[model samples]
Target: MKLKKVVLAVSMLVAIAGGTAQAQAQPVKNIVLVHGAFVGGAGWRAVYDRLTHDGYNVTLVQEPLTSFAQDVAATRRVLDRQNGPVILVGHSYGGAIISEVGNDNKVAGLVYIAAHVPENGETEADNGKKIPNSAHPFVKSSDGYLSIAPEYYHADFAADLPAAQADFEAHAQMPTNAAVFTANIPHPAWKTRPSWYMVAKADKIISPDLERLYAKRAHSHTVEIAGASHSVYQSHPDEVARLIEQAAQHALP
Candidate 1:
């Protein structure tokens, strides 16, 4: 009778420990990715694959490029659909959207991939004014929409990318409204949240110096990738994925 009682106690303890361990284990769930201006969710295909392979649920948001409020609304829509906490990742102009939308309680953390980290009431146009105009000839604004000039796509936006790949991205690029650039972000979420930033050292569109300034202001965990263009996520998907993973880990208890 004594032996049987001891055996039952040991089994219960083992089961309790197993249950606790399972409860404590980190859950792999959704990460909603937002792309910058002149691009759509399609741009994140590489990063999406990497995240999915690492056991993350991933959703790519296709911003309307209509205005800041619209973009934030679109991101919030995705955030609402997620089952667990979301890691909100944004690039370039998309960062501005995340800065506003990521304030939601559902957001686990934020990742800026060569993205703008604007302060409250600041607009993309305001930040762009601080940097000298890009020497790359591919960008143009007309009829209230901004687009990349097809000719300079390979050399300016994706210099490190193969000519063929660059050309394809250039061709598939989406046009954004110029008004979106001027729209101010009433609330910048990064100011109140833990954030991670990736700096594209070789970025020509947005100055590297400015990237440093924004990251510093946001008090972000930052990593600098050398020889990368503005589209560093495309040029360095693995590094971007690693940064997102780190951000997610930081959000865990």
Candidate 2:
């Protein structure tokens, strides 16, 4: 009877120790993902699933795309909800939002996914002008807003994706005011914060050369993937998720 009790006690102790170790190993902070212009938070669904499945807390921001200030405000609202330090991630135009909002005290790191990494006082329009083939059909100006034309959804923005998925995304693309693209970022978070960049070599919407230039200027740790379109998070979700996971690890204390 005494031997049985001893074994039971030992088992319980071992279980307790294992539980403690697991808790310690797990990262407590959340990751905030911001999607760029023409798409809503829904675009990050695949990445959100992957991060959550791997035991990471994640939030995807639905930017208003009305103006740069509005987008940054939206991202900041999401950041305020996180309990601890956060990894701020942006895709495409979302990167510009992160650049402005990522300087918050709560932001531990920044990740740019086929996204812009602009310097202070730089606007997306300025960068786009530098690239010859950066124009998209959906990208148009109405009144004062910038929007993507529905027809160029599959061919320009996401040529590598399936027709149905591309169509769905194009239809779901968010509209950004021209003011957002024209507004220059006042303070770029990449100036002080650690950053990671992913370059989509096959990107047709944004010139691959421009992406490289931004990555180089930011001095960001970069990962290049070939054959991936601008919507890399959807077409190569696992890879994008893994990079995000790595960024989270880098951000952890």
| TM-score of model number 2 | 0.86
Q: Write the per-residue lDDT of candidate 1 for residues 1-253, one digit (tens) a residue.
A: 9999999999999999999877646753779999998877887888889999998989989878887778888888888999978889999988888888888988868899888888867776778787754645435565767788878877777888899988888888888887877777777888788889999998887888888888999999999999999889988999999999888777645
- Expressed as tens digits, the lDDT of each residue in 1-253 for candidate 2 is 9999999999999999999877656553589999987888887888888889988889989888877777888899999999988899999988888998888998878899999887877777788888744555445664766666667778778888899988887777777787777767777989888888899988877888989999999888899989988989788889888887777776544
Question: How does model 2 fare in lDDT?
Answer: 0.83
Residue 137 alpha-carbon offset, candidate 2, angstroms: 4.7
Any runs in candidate 2 off by more than 4 Å, and if so which? 1-28, 134-141
Candidate 2 C-alpha RMSD relative to the actual structure: 5.8
TM-score of each: 0.87, 0.86
In candidate 1, which residue ranges exceed 4 Å CA deviation?
1-28, 137-142
